[model samples]
Target chain A: IAGITQAPTSQILAAGRRMTLRCTQDMRHNAMYWYRQDLGLGLRLIHYSNTAGTTGKGEVPDGYSVSRANTDDFPLTLASAVPSQTSVYFCASSDTHSTGELFFGEGSRLTVL
Target chain B: AQSVTQLDSQVPVFEEAPVELRCNYSSSVSVYLFWYVQYPNQGLQLLLKYLSGSTLVKGINGFEAEFNKSQTSFHLRKPSVHIRDTAEYFCAVKRAGYALNFGKGTSLLVTP
Candidate 1:
């Protein structure tokens, strides 16, 4: 089953450019999240959505924004990419709001130069 | 707020040797603990979790962990290791309605 799908599996972007990371889940989970993983730093939540049409900012939301228009898709956007934004981004979803097991996507490796 | 700490950044062990990866967390309220494994070029997968009931929780791939409330620790253990077990392990903690807080992660390398 395609539990979670994220695309442009890898990308290289110039600083100040805008980029969007696509994420979709077939499980129809109520909650979805965007997290960035860096070397020596574990995954940090960028944004999350508890359900359709509702979004929340996470720990590191400075350069990122997310939207949840439907239950299946929650995309992250970087308005102005910076060199420090280079990292692997993962999309995860859970069956419940916060206490369910999370299923993660393969990840999108973004390089901001 | 909840935070997780993985003591080891990297661990190297010979094949067939027992291994342990230590994890600890800090939280004022009750917390849920989890262990996740990430292979090269892949997303993280759940290894095990400790929500309640049993202090010792068994997970897939012969992995197990014990929750020590007194010490605020949940250390993963495996009796013997294989090369396939080499990967990055993460420890995470979460409150009832909060986002999961993850540790930096520990890379396990099993050599022949």
Candidate 2:
């Protein structure tokens, strides 16, 4: 079912460059999220959407922006990439209910030089 | 705001030995707890969760965790570990109407 899929499995971007991390899910989930995983630090939330057209800031939303244009797509954009933004990004989706389990994408490893 | 704390950053154990990963959380209101596993170069996957049921929650891969309200803890335990169990484990808490809060992950290394 391709639960959740992220684009550009891995990438190398120069500092100050703009990049977008695409996330898509076929499950038609109402909620989607973006998170970054770094060494020692666990997964930190970057942005989230409760449903189509509604997005919210998360724990670590700096340097990142997200839009939920539809139920299937939620993309994260970095206006200006920085070395601090270099980390594995994951996309996740969950059903309308918060109690439901979350489905995660493989991940997008971004290296900013 | 809710927060999670994973007591151990790394745990080394041998195959067939029991292992435990401790987790503590602080929140102003009641919350749901979960444990997720991430293999090398992979995304996080749900290992188990503690909702409103019994204290002990059993999940896939023979892993289990117990939720303690007074202690504010949800410790993951596996009676016998396998080489495949080597991975990073995360403890998470979901506050009402909020995103999940994850603690620093615990890297479990199961040696043969």
Residue-wise C-alpha lDDT for candidate 2, range B29-71, written one tens digit per residue: 9999999999998888999999897999999999999999999
Candidate 1, what DockQ? Answer: 0.79
Candidate 1 yields a Cα-based lDDT of 0.94
- Model 2 error, position B19 (Å): 0.4
**Candidate 1 chain B: 10-residue stretch with minimal lDDT:** B93-102
lDDT of 1 by residue, A3-40 (tens): 99999999999999999999999998999999999999
Please, what are the lDDT tens digits per residue for candidate 2 over residues A16-103?
Answer: 9999999999998999999998998888999999999999998899999998889999999999999999999999998857585688
DockQ of each: 0.79, 0.78
Q: Which 10-residue window in model 2 chain A sums to the lowest lDDT? A: A94-103
Mark the regions of model 2 whose C-alpha exceeds 4 Å error after superposition. none
Candidate 1, position B96, lDDT: 79
- Local distance difference test, each candidate: 0.94, 0.94
Which pairs of residues clash in candidate 2, taking residues 3 or more apart in a chain or in different chains? none
